[model samples]
Target: MRVSVKVKPGSKKGPLVETDEDGSLIVFLRERAVDGAANEALVKTLAKHFETRSANITIESGHSSRLKRVRIEE
Candidate 1:
C-alpha cells in the first residue's frame, strides 16, 4: 500500500499521528530532519503504528521534503 504523509520533525507535540480530509497522514516526530534521523524515526514509528516491520516501509519519494510518499509492503 502507498500512503501520502506530511512529517513534522523535531516536534514536542510528537508521537502523534493525524489524518487529513484528503486521506493523507500527518505524523508528528521528535527526531529532527538531520542526517536521516527523522526518516528513520518515521519508519520505526509508522511500523509500530501499522503493526508492520520497519523493513517493510520505504520512502518512495520526497526524501528531503516534509511531504513524502511511503510504500508499505503488507
Candidate 2:
C-alpha cells in the first residue's frame, strides 16, 4: 500500500498522527534533520510501527522534504 507521510524533525517527543482529511501519516522524529539523522529516525520509527526491520523501509521519494513517500517491504 502507498501512504503519504509528513515528517516532523527535531521534535521533543516522537509520535505518529493521522491527518483527518487526507489520512496521511504524520511522523515526529526526535533527531534533528541533519546528516540524514531525521531520515534514519523516520525509518526506525516506521519499521517499528509496521513491525518490520529498518532495512525493510525505503524512502522512495522526497528525501529532502517534509513530505515523503516510503515503501515498506513485506
Model 1 segments more than 4 A misplaced: none
Q: By TM-score, who's the top model here?
A: 1
Q: Residue 6's C-alpha lDDT in candidate 2? A: 92
Tens-digit lDDT track of model 1 for 1-74: 99999999999999788999999999999999999999999999899999999999999999999999999999
Tens digits of per-residue lDDT, candidate 2, 1-74, equal 56688999988768564454678888988888999999998999888898989988999999999999988888
Candidate 2: lDDT of 19?
59
TM-score attained by model 1:
0.97
TM-score of 2: 0.88
- What is each predicted model's overall lDDT from 0 to 1? 0.96, 0.85
Candidate 2 segments whose C-alpha is farther than 4 A from its true place = 15-20
lDDT, candidate 2, residue 49?
90
